[model samples]
Target: MRTDRIFGLAVVLGALAYIASAFQLQTSFLSDPVGSRTFPIIVGSVAAVCGLVMVVSPDPEPDWPHGRTWARLGIAVLVLVGYAYALRPWGFVLPTALAAGIISYQINPRPMAAALTGIGLSVGLYLLFKYALGLGLMALPRDFPG
Candidate 1:
């Protein structure tokens, strides 16, 4: 029940889940030759290897919980869940910006800097995923004529 053991278990479980999900993915004639499952398989393998390494390694000293650590983690989880739920409704830009802002707030308490950083991250990610990766994530509300 040590932190290292817990982390190792988490990694193993994550890997297993990834692998299982990949196995469950259906394929079609239009699917890429490598298929969507390839990356997940690779990731799961890497995670399993890392988990094994962590399990074999000596445990590190555990740090006592800081007052804000749990709060920060909660904020991070909220941001991630919000992003998932808001992606289609709010589109890419606003939800991404909000998520980035929440993450930045945890990293730095300065409001102005966090806001700017979030804007930069949102724009940058939009360009990266939409242009470079050809993801075509909508940047605005669907009904807006813009």
Candidate 2:
């Protein structure tokens, strides 16, 4: 089996699991109009469809990454995981900026640009989520800037 097909199969299986788990989410009368399970189910469904497409028509000559690229990929995954853990304690901005900075620097290898990208993306996403979407995300920790 081709690597892409294997990856696609994994994605399909993971998406199925995600969808199944989403069904387990308990909602109340006070839940949002879309409900808590809706987004996860939609995301899982989309992922399943994309995975099926990849399984049906994978790249004939997939140029797999090598050497430092693999390291960078691993680092990016670690950063994201750390970001998830740090979100509640550190709030949104600081951890997000660090994670985005590291990942952006890995992609571009430019310190200043990466810093700008990190700060810009962190603030942009914060505003978009908090203000535009009316989501109550903490911009910083309660005692921050003191």
Candidate 3:
């Protein structure tokens, strides 16, 4: 299948997932008038529309996937899973930084650039989740106050 076709199918699947999530979500008394399902429903509707558009649009040049692409994708997934498992024990910084670094390396060839990008992303995420959102993400060993 062509890349565009695959992308279109992915979009459709995402929309279906969103729609299903919206339906399956439990409502609470504290829920606003829009409800927890509203956003998902809207997102699903938009994704469905975009998928439909893609499906009907003119096909672009087909670019077949190489073996290395699959390997890279597998590595990325593995990194993500490792990060999830490592988050609690290793805390947010190290695992997140490693994951970001791996992703950066996958996208870029330069080692220094990849490392910097990863560190930058990790710090930015820390600031966003910790300070901006006030989330209690596990801190690094050095940052932990016992």
Off by over 4 Å in 1: 1-61
Top of the candidates by TM-score: 2
Tens digits of per-residue lDDT, candidate 3, 12-84, equal 9989988997999999889788888988898899998898778768387577568998898899999999888
lDDT of 2 by residue, 38-73 (tens): 999999999999999989999885687999999999
Question: Model 3, which residues run further than 4 Å from truth?
Answer: 1-63, 141-146
Q: RMSD of each candidate?
A: 7.8, 8.3, 7.1
Per-model TM-score, in order, reads 0.56, 0.57, 0.53
Q: lDDT: which is higher, 1 or 2? A: 2
- lDDT for 116 in candidate 1 is 90
The 0-to-1 C-alpha lDDT of every candidate, in the order given, reads: 0.87, 0.93, 0.85
Better of 1 and 3 by lDDT: 1
Model 2 clash pairs are none
Best by lDDT: 2
Error of 2 at 29 (Å): 31
Q: Residue-wise lDDT of candidate 1 within 53-81, one digit each (tens)?
A: 77778378587668789888888998898
